[model samples]
Target: MDNIIKANQFIQEGKLEEAAKILNEAIQENPNDTVAYVNFGHLLSIIGEKERAIAFYQKAIEIDQTMATAYYGAGNTYYDQEMFEEAVGMFKEAIANGLVEADAYFMLGLCYYNLGNLPHALANLLTATEKNPTDIDAMFQYGLTLAQTEQVDEAISVLEKVIKLDENHADAYYNLGVAYAFKEDIEKALASFEQALKIQPGHLLAGNGKKQLEALL
Candidate 1:
């Protein structure tokens, strides 16, 4: 089997040191292999070697300017470091290079959300959900962005979808309660909050929401 494949199997089997050794040897044997470089970068990132991961991603980019995975890997590292602006640039580059994964769009949305660009964040998150309807995180973010933009009804609908996707999604239930409260549907809001707390005992937001609803009643 190929060294990259073997390394990937090792990684899946939780043998990080073996995987790292194989990847390192593969890089040394084929320095120009962009895929190997990107995979190695991802492994390094998982092990908390953020700087080294970015360096490997940069090396992959140097070898193949059109390597979208390399750009996306580097963007993820930047995001982890809280460098939202740099992450936005790299994610956009990945998109421009034809990386159409939901994760790329989701990360771009998160970057825009972090930068307080609500419209752009909504747009990207909406696209991410469109690309992968089953991605609960993307759906949750899309719902949250809608709520932030004051689209309360739409936010409720999206949050409901998230709840359907994962019944135990406490944050979705809490956000749904918030949306219902914004619409002055006090009874529904209280019920949603109760559901959230039921799923995640002692959820602070759910508890607060329930208290506020009770006071209103």
Candidate 2:
């Protein structure tokens, strides 16, 4: 346990080799320590040894099927590799094993989104937003998902909330413009697009949107 704590400190300090050495020692001393395995998996992930990270996480899951963190770690590794199908199962397992963090739900929703399962993505993202109402990223993504699923009014409302929470969220304004455009509110859409361009001068989408809306006027 001391070794693991020391290893974690080393990890935080960016002394990865030192952390690895200490973690190896910890694993040698107690091969059955799930905590050590999970920490090692996280270290491997950080170092871009994604396959090794998955192996370590799987080992932890093998020893304790109810290890929520192991499943969550594996889910992240798979997600990083763009293996959304595999990541979906891992995230679902993590949730079933008692990892109900909003982040977990958000990742699960992302996996569903990537896999083109819009209904499920919407459902999970809704849960994620409910779990953490102030999470701007989740709320923003949920707004996009709503628009994708043809919920234009809901998307506008959520995007508005995101803008209220962080006035500099250019993407939120851009998407709000799209939502308003979809609802046939030309002036509101143009105003939203202009606000987005004001916040982010480099926003090509907003620029194009502004030009298109201006042409309509």
If scored against the real structure, what TM-score would every candidate get?
Answer: 0.97, 0.97
Clashing pairs in 1: none
On the 0 to 100 scale, the lDDT of residue 119 in model 1 is 97
Task: Return the lDDT, model 2, position 103.
Answer: 96
**lDDT of every predicted structure (CA atoms):** 0.94, 0.94
Lowest summed lDDT across 10 adjacent residues in model 1 is found at 1-10
Q: After superposition, how far is residue 42 of candidate 1 from its true place, in Å?
A: 0.9
C-alpha lDDT (0 to 100) for residue 43 of candidate 2? 97
Name model 2 segments beyond 4 Å from true.
none
* Candidate 2 per-residue lDDT over residues 1-217, each given as its tens digit: 8888998999999999999988888889889999899999999999999999999999999999999999999999999999999999999999999999899999999999999999999999999999999999999999999999999988888999898889999999999998898888999999999999999999999999999988888
Q: What are the RMSDs of all candidates, in order? A: 1.1, 1.0
